[model samples]
Target: MIDIPSMQRAGANAVKAIIDDVISEKLDVEKKFSSSKTAFRIADLGCSVGPNTFIAMQNIIDAVQQKYQSQGFASHMPEFQVFFNDHTSNDFNTLFASLPPERPYFATGVPGSFHGRLFPDFSLDFVHSSFALQWLSKVPEELLSKNSAAWNKGRVHYASAPDEVAQAYTVQFAKDITTFLEGRAKELVVGGLMVLNMPGIPNGNPHSSSVTGLSFDILGHCLVDMAKEGLISEVQVDSFNVPIYVASPKEMT
Candidate 1:
């Protein structure tokens, strides 16, 4: 498994802010769910192996319950059906094994890519993704083609890449995000809520100078060192690139 304590810590730190924002938008939830008498259907997109996913889902459930109760609809509280989605190759057995016995909602695993259609139209009431959208569906094909202007030579990502390479990645990210939104739009019911949390570059900051960019630079240096030590070939390093892009808020909008 990918053991990154810092990553988990960062995710935990952001959870409160995310939950608060979602709760503050209770008016929207009330509007959507007030008339519904059926079980609430929630989909946690890109929800990887758990603890964090559990916390997020519980917070959403609590927020929804509180919203309905505040509206004097305590008797109308709906059952929850939570779907944890991830790639087909993900270790779903491990994810399901760690579920808490006291979970308030019924849970199931949905293995598929979020960049494409994974559910039927208008079937979901809430959707969430955390620290996941930065991952592109696939690397930009142009970056790997020697004849393409966006050839990403001597690098694994767009951190210090040339303008053309950076542009290629940016274009690819836009396309992926568009596909993701389109898929979600078709799946979610009217007034449904979607919360997406991803790494982003600040406005007025250079993309290559951001904290995430710098981290990628350090990783690239390590890969270069490995190549020098004959642990891997320089050509392999040049050919391989991370299918991740830290977009700006403006880009997302």
Candidate 2:
């Protein structure tokens, strides 16, 4: 089985590498911002209640400072303002309580789905999302429609399902991604960078081949068994679907 924390660590390391190499050239630190604050703005979209988000944000702050120092602009270093965004149901209190006591950045919690616009135009200097995009806004409605060809009768995910079911998920994902990209495009300032770290399968591979897919398959079977044993209704089992779409590399492109 693939360890989730390991994957998250790998993504964080990749983010660090990108920031170290290109951030200095890509971002214009001296540019006059529309906001009156003396702080550099960063948004971590889909940041769950965790220490990993803190680690990633710190890495960014350090890299930005290094960039300024290397360019002999250390005396005018900007304060850091970090926005931690996630679903409204997330435990913001816990996230705030666990923050590092001596952290340099001023943190704020923003609750909303990243698929929609959450920030004002040209508001963010850098944006980051880690291991969060697989979750769709909601389960594809076709999967729950008895009259639809894509109805996922006994399954809780697209994996190992019929082509119609998978296609339904793909279409929904495409729409959701378009909305997400448009929002980010409007939110990020000119010369700003956005780093996204999401799970994906290799090109030409079926989602069912991955561990996540297999886990969903197992869950679907368990639910079916439960229905058979009268623990849940068959209709309920038919209506339930996991709102995640683990895209392949091709799908992502």
| lDDT against true structure, model 2 | 0.87
Q: What is the lDDT of residue 44 in candidate 1?
A: 84
C-alpha local distance difference test of each model: 0.83, 0.87
Q: What is the lDDT of residue 92 in candidate 2?
A: 100
RMSD per model, one decimal? 2.2, 2.1
What is candidate 1's lDDT per residue for 1-253, written digit by digit as tens? Answer: 2344457447755775776667556436456555656778898888888878888888888888887787687787789999999999988999999998999999999999999899999988889888889999999999898999888877888988888988988999999999999999999888777888777887757778977777777788898999999999999988999898989888987
Q: How big is the positional error of residue 253 in model 2, measured in Å on the Cα after superposition?
A: 3.1
Runs of candidate 1 with Cα error greater than 4 angstroms are: 1-9, 12-15, 23-36
Q: Compose the digit string of candidate 2's lDDT tens values, residues 49-154.
A: 8788998899889988898888777887889899999999999999999999999999999999999999999888889889889889988888888999999999
TM-score of each: 0.92, 0.92
Task: Write down the worst ten-residue block by lDDT for model 1.
Answer: 1-10
Count of clashes in candidate 1: 0
In model 2, which runs have C-alpha deviations exceeding 4 angstroms?
A: 1-6, 32-37
